[model samples]
Target: MRPLLLLPLLITTASAADAVITYDEHIKPIFREHCLKCHGEDEQKADLNLANFTAVLKGGSGDKAVVAGRASTSLLFKAITAEDDAERMPPKKAAIPAPQIELIRQWIQGGLRESSASKSLVAARDTSFKAATALNFDGPPPMPESLPAFTPPQLKRPLPVIAMAASPRAPLIAVAGHEHVRLLDATTQQEIGALPFPEGQPNVIRFSRDGRVLMVAGGKPVQSGSVVLFEVKSGKRLTSVGDETDAVISADLSPDQKLIALGGSGKIVKVYGTDDGKLRHKLTKHTDWITALAFSPDGKSLASADRAGGIHLWDGTSGGILLTLAEHKAAVRALAWRSDSHMLASGGEDGLLIWWDTTDGWPAITNTNAHPPVRPAGYYGKLPNGVLALAFGPQGELLSAGRDKQVRLWAADGRALKSFASETALPLQTSITFDGKGLFAGDAAGAVRFWTTAN
Candidate 1:
């Protein structure tokens, strides 16, 4: 009888140790004991009701309480683990026990499972984009022939252009406008058509490598966010990815068009499938808002940068970290990979432009004053020196715009070739034409301008 009782006790202990940590089984009990008084059915604080799993995920008035795959970045975890007595949860009480806090961490890191029978709500699929031998096109490049027409949205004022992209294979330019994308001809500089983005203002616009599709990514800040894709020819909405709580700040589609990687104020890089829109990978390594993202043209590497100046190169398919290229001391504003995938150029608020050799992740060329400020005659407070945008030409040339109100060109070997001054309005975005004979730029004053290459 004693032996049988001991065997049952042993089995129960083993089962408890191995069972999944879930909201219903483990988390709710803890909340009820410690959190329910101020955040439950009867009473709510900070517009937060933590009586159920949904409410917990919905978060309070601020950022989301629990980020699905990252416990370290979750607000709930921070609240419970805070060092200050006043800011910590259960306000005046001691912090949660270490073991219980660990359980919460596991619950979040395990995709916030509600029960043992439940699937992970934020599981990443194993997917990768395979690169082709070369970016070769058989016929004339894809162009919008008969796109469906749409009325452009009327704005209170012209929205400041936030993003822009030039088609790699076509004489086309996509410019972000107020709740719409304006397509323009690179040669004539005339409006071709408009695509409505009902989601919100677009913060990032990108054309696929083959120039067959365009992607627009953004949404209402602190409310919702997403990425929308469109067929360049028919203007058909291809697909949308992500359901984020804040606007997506940076995004890029892989050269093969099989994967889309995006990041936002959430500080997480999410790669999703273009066909099915399922999340493929969630990279939570950045400590600040992601400011830039780019996939190598050859489709092997994905480079992402953050507001804190961190940059990481990842395997395009597996989402594994390949290298951490750390040189910039301020926000990295733009990242552009060379066509051959051998080099990457990064511009940052530190006023430095660096070209990294992908072979060993070393800075091949570092321009300390890529866009030196030109202050006016007697105004000596400080002039803007940040590199705001970057684009690469077909022949390895580079175009960059800076907060100094100048647009400049550079040779493949880091030689300064030409410079165009914007005079008043700051140039915010830039793109080079396919033939490398023209330049397109959007400025802070809500103007999109074009220039021919100087003789």
Candidate 2:
């Protein structure tokens, strides 16, 4: 009887055992049960995919999850083996049992073989990859490739506008003002809607990634802080979150519309879950008030700027501080993350725009004084008079607006592209928004304007 029991146990551990643990049969189940619900099929957490062998190798968020025969060095294994409870994988739950853990180790050691169950997941991942790869634009034929003289547009309004954002799927644009928020048609320069707020002036207005929600932040005069969300088409109020007494200086949404990051109140960067308006994480690391927050395109990390001239990188899920950058000389006000690269673009009050390569953990790209440097008669100086807002166009162009009353476009590499100036004399403080087809500008007198390339 003892010999028969030994034979069965030996057969179970043998390489020819019927229950072969391949990437499809054993490893995928491990991920589904212990990993994927957060970082797998439903969502790509940490920019990683465990749904298939290919996606596991392609990696996500920051680094590769698997390294072929090196499970001990793989980020996925490292996360799962984290000694610190907060750093452990499937975070917020107990560690996986040892037998299940050994299966992952054996799978990694066996070259991570894939089975039929992984085919569907691999096909889905490949489709997404191909779609992203096939996107190519000629960029308006390079505008004849010459040093065209800068010509500022003539302004029709007299007051200043602060910030703006355009809807991705429509001609609608939202503009921020002293005491009102206005929506406009990007093609006709027509005011579509004007909503007034008596509680406080708005500091910024941005459209959600899906274009279904618009978020407005500002406090009324004598009242300091608040943030509001409204339906884009009907102008109906959706919900308001945070203290009305704490001024929300800047805000942005995650790429998937699952989170909102609010910059306000004593260096706090509050991240809220969009589904229930619940506080997900409150990042407290900046020494001064936060001025800007931008999530990376993959949605695993967040970049934040502050009045203390600091920029920070945070892990989106755990809210852990990953990096702190201090290259700006003054308050950092504007920040934009490139959609396909590990680079961050920032503008500061010191009249400079710099791009940092997050991969190298240093300032790898720089564009000093991004605004037009010369001031002609009735022309604001080159740099946005004050870098009040920054955004990325559909084709990845950088657009920025300044207190000096101008909006300038820049190539992804930080080269100057174009500049638009209103012909008016009111010291513009303009807000600019863009759709793939055109650019929209809003000014202080509650006027919105549009510009586009002639077809």
Candidate 3:
């Protein structure tokens, strides 16, 4: 009897020694010491606060930074577990200790739970879950369900891409680099087409409204700014528009596909007739470089944003200035007009996505640190920065690509929704087009990925 009792006592001691760490003991201290400075109770970095249990679960800018029951799907674990020094957590200078990382992993695998201290923290605070609200960004009209999952193909090139755009109709994706534009099949990682222009480093590529033409912009050394329109199917150059000077920074087409608007260094917007490639109008009102331009869904008005962060609206038919929208502190980079025509979304270098009410001339909604605010906006919340690409689901959930080579989902109102990584590889640029099915994304590495709404 005595020997049996001693054996049971020894087993209990060993079990206690191997017990998994809880939220209070192992996780909170690590977060407080390393992560809370940027993501804490007072300030939420990327809209994430890690000061307490509820906040950690609540997540930040995008949702599901961590999945409670699954460590593999948790972004926090992935970031901490990153192999590359540049991809590691704490961003530039900070590093997570090895023991702490192991502790987190063990806790997650054993079913993450709150400790006595964490329970106290929860008891001291309100721990109710708040349903996130919808954010107003433009894409396909919001749907009740998300699209199905589709993976993007990976490309061989490792060069960082600056801009990406999907073909209007086909599965072709145009990836803009320093001197070449790679045409990739949206469904397969295969390179079906390639356009090389050493004389011009294309900064942006946009398809014609009809999806019949591909327009390329930017210039090479000693070459003036130019715009080349090509037939998508044959890859044949349809028309080339340029002058002795003037580099085109951004371009867009009217809804009718008859008019083309180009903005760049000349402080002027040149409108051309697409049929004959003839110049029709030159509207000049901006004092700085035009960083972004878009035509309303109705094609009645043309919107232009400049480096000075001023938005100028023009009458599409007449070369007349309608109104100047101003509020951003830096150059505006991304612009989208909602289908409703009542709202216009503009993102700038300041990392804010502002939804402007065209009717009231005021912001209907605002999300700070919205994205990196670069040109040729990738998927939803994803910026063109080296970090990740963001997109919005049909249900208005935010989807983002992680530097750890993963894709994360978030609620439209900036709550983390879910997270998933490519089983194959990371994509260069991830984008979602509104095709009535679901959101589709294209990566730089030549992969087309899809995510369907869950029932």
Candidate 4:
């Protein structure tokens, strides 16, 4: 009888220790899911802001939520445990489960220990059951004890992740920050390694059609534009070319891996020999800064889009513009060629998704806008803002990330299938790609979020 009584106390102590909560690891996530949608940085319903600890402690129109050591009288506890539907928090579900509520109660009663950063990334994601634990393989990769020497710290004015690329042959995605590219395992959304290009923040990170090599292009403004080639698996830089005098924003390695083409603020598109870094051809037709580029899967055609709402389809062998696409009313920012090598997709600041038919004789733009529903636009307008990134799925489906922070799936005929709206407020998703089984989005906040492809 004595041992049995002590066993209950021991179990209670251990569970209490495990349940000790923190701001980022526990409370922040809870508030994010249930409260922040209504009282976050954007809206602040009832003048309550719970997005951060300071705001939560300061409370809202009601009063302070926590009183240091009392959980029974805390307004937060009362609202969440209220029996009346109108007075209940979250106002949707019956309420947070008793286990989580008990954890919150224990957390307030025991002095709100803010757990260290070592556990924040995985805290709220703990699995519930043994079987579920086995399936919970989603998270950031194990971070090193310290960042690599070449990797720059996330600066005060963080560099915008302007470019991201996904390999067609594997589950790897590359995201560009200031002066380096982070290669992530698309399935797990973990940082696998860093590919270093220290001259400047990379404007573009593109893998070859075979996915064996990655080409990076960018440099300090007006000084020199550099392009570097690195072996994908080993991170061994193979070649470097520093000749251009402006930022190189658009670049790609041809399917044959024999040539690399890039264009930038210099306004001249140039192709270089992959083996010797020698200039192969220079095509100067556009009058504005180049923004996006892609090579057809068959390696026959190269498409380059510019800031003037113009897309030039060039013959890879002759460097001549094959057909000029002028459907966008603003700058074209993203371009993707279907896997079949027959159709092209382009998106721009005008909130239009135009498909181009690429046949033997006639190549003209299709008249369709694969815009997702207007709900994500909030009170702004009928359509989401511009499309900043685009990708094609394995079976010719389309995926695009918009300025409205919605990622939408589309059929090949320009029909919207489903849309995933990001939960974070004011997330300007700058880049997006598909990795066969999942979709990866990189936003201006330097975070890459991955989600399972919704069928």
Candidate 5:
């Protein structure tokens, strides 16, 4: 008799416990932290992609990630459920919990509905500024064409920033976030000026050595990519570089202002003439996405680093590969050359600070972990994490920021001088820039933070 009265209550509780696991609410976050990096952006390994709804439906190499309503037979499910460590879904991870696996099982056995996250993914994929084009050596593409006619509100939503730079000569710091660039006063962090980059989110922003012209590189994914030169003081568009089909991930303005070099998804670094925007060198050697590029302080040498930890030095005037420097174990995200251009400082996925003797056949001068390898996410302290930004202080000290959300300074010889954590950031301060007096970092909260020497 008592059970009769409580039966309906128990039934309601059980139904509530089986709440739906929609892509946005339950699944995306799990995939976001664990799977997307390799199968999503930057590169699609094994041709498999979990970045979007369509990609999941159009599975890679092994084919059919999910056959709707058949989770047990799906390759995606099998990979996750495989008992053999080598066959596991993450391939390398300790194994996903049974609860998450069961949740995913329910999702597939149910139907892969176009949830809110799926719709958003589809929208982002379709919002390419320009349809992707093949790599062409013809003079860079033109702006406006390189940019979409209408900016997508989603891309303009101030995604986590990837680039921040301080003018070595001016009291200005340039922060590239979402679809615009903000120039802030180095001392006060006040907005000095802003540039509307409807072309796409800027991937990198650099002020000319004198701090008068700001060189910006970025573009839509799988779409037109280009660089713009803006008169920092007047906020006028000065010059633009073209002929790219993807966002420009890295760029540098030569010290002498004679040449500018940049590289990104194309796997080729293109060096251009600053005066006429002419293609000067089509430096090709990188087999993966180019992640870092720089013209030496003297502007006599150009250094390019890629996701595979490859480093190449090229003749400044000729665009000829001079040497392939000692590389990293994983992607090298940050590169800083000594003021004299005698040494190069690099930090990457290994969480190590490496000094390269650029003049001595680019030999490794010092290799030490900038931060201890974080476990579970990082193996043996190995990547999927590392220093994402580096800058040389006015006194030649190296400044670096990384996934650990820490800022550390190192002596010219690679001695760890100081380290500290700011209370404001969520984590992963990805970009660091030095303005002679202060260190500026870009955080995941869509903020550019300035830390003084005293801090």
Candidate 6:
């Protein structure tokens, strides 16, 4: 009898034992004994019903209980295996058996199957973002034809414009406002249209590679969060991705528009599928909240920076860690990739603007004190010199704003071309127009100011 028990335990831990797990055959009995009382047919907790296979797959309360192939991110698995007594399932009850937890994990990772003959429901995806060999602009760039009518919220005061983006191929700019986004004609500096952001304030605005789609990422702080997409030509709401516990501070879409990566209060950088909204990869290497994220225009690499000033460049295709850039000593505020994707730029709160050559992960140019503090005599302590935002121009020039309340333009060789000073507001965001003739900067005072190379 002792040998028989030991034999089964050994098989469970052996690498050769890759047994198929199904909900009907293996999971039903375990849930009936431990989870049915609270989450089964009789009573549903948090609106989650785990009584049947379909119900478990459907999820509840606007969240999925079982994410097909990700056991670690599945709500059902997290609940049953939670370390906290309060969050753990079967409230106040003894922990579920280790074997049972293992079974559940196998069920999810092997794909949530209904029975022995049912098909595996694992979300198999190609994570790579293949860039186009060359950008082909056949005609004029896409613009909104007819947008849905939306009543703009009457604001008592202008909300701080924290996020903004310029189209890669058009004279348009999207500026984030309070629960809304304003589209401006870069040439005229006039409002062309507006789009509603029912989700909280838009923390990050991005245009797709072709400038045909708009991606806005944000949500109510300390509450719900998600990424919203819209068709640029029609102002049609496309889809929303991610359901985070807090606001997403930074996010970007791949060059092919196949993947969306976002981060916020959580240290993890979650990449999701644009079509199915499934969690594809969780880059958990960051030690602090992710403050900046961007993918290379060539769609070969991804860069994620954190509040701790840690910057990591990853393989854009497989999400593999490529390089850990250790330079900034404070929060990273912005990340920009050149059109050719050979160079990457990062601005941080430490007042350093570094240009990195992605080929070998070396700093090609480091601008220490990129934003020199303008302090009068007797100014004490640390005068603010943090680089707030960065943008790349078409000709490989760079635009940067900083705590110095000045927006400066830099040449491809890191030479200071010109500086535009904003006397009233501190610039927080900056973007360059497609043709490299115009630039836009959003400030702390909720103003989206426009300028050109001639300035």
Each model's TM-score, in the order given?
Answer: 0.70, 0.59, 0.54, 0.62, 0.63, 0.70
Candidate 2 vs candidate 4, TM-score winner: 4
| CA deviation > 4 Å runs, candidate 4 | 1-158, 360-384, 425-435
On residues 126-226, what C-alpha lDDT tens digit does candidate 2 reach at each position?
10111123223333211111222323233454335666777755666777654667666666666656655444667767776556677787775345776
Per candidate, the number of residue pairs that clash is: 0, 23, 37, 1, 5, 0
lDDT of 5 by residue, 252-325 (tens): 88877778888989899998887899998898899899999988877778889999988888988888888887
Candidate 4 accuracy as TM-score: 0.62
For model 6, residues 378-410, the per-residue Cα lDDT tens digits are: 978879779999999888889999998988887
Q: Judge candidate 2 at residue 77 and give its lDDT.
A: 78
Residue-level error in angstroms, candidate 5, position 423: 4.1
- The reply for model 2, stretches above 4 Å from the true place, is 1-159, 196-198, 221-224, 375-386, 403-405, 425-435, 443-447
Q: TM-score of predicted model 5?
A: 0.63
Q: Candidate 4, overall lDDT?
A: 0.68
**Model 6 residue 347 lDDT?**
93
Alpha-carbon deviation at 133 in model 4, angstroms? 39
* Residue 363 of model 4, lDDT score: 21
The residue pairs in collision within model 1 are none
Taken over the whole model, the C-alpha lDDT of each candidate is 0.83, 0.64, 0.60, 0.68, 0.68, 0.84
* Residue 210 displacement in candidate 3 (angstroms): 3.1
Sort the predicted structures by TM-score, highest score first: 6, 1, 5, 4, 2, 3
Residue clash pairs of candidate 5: 140-242, 140-243, 141-242, 141-243, 373-381
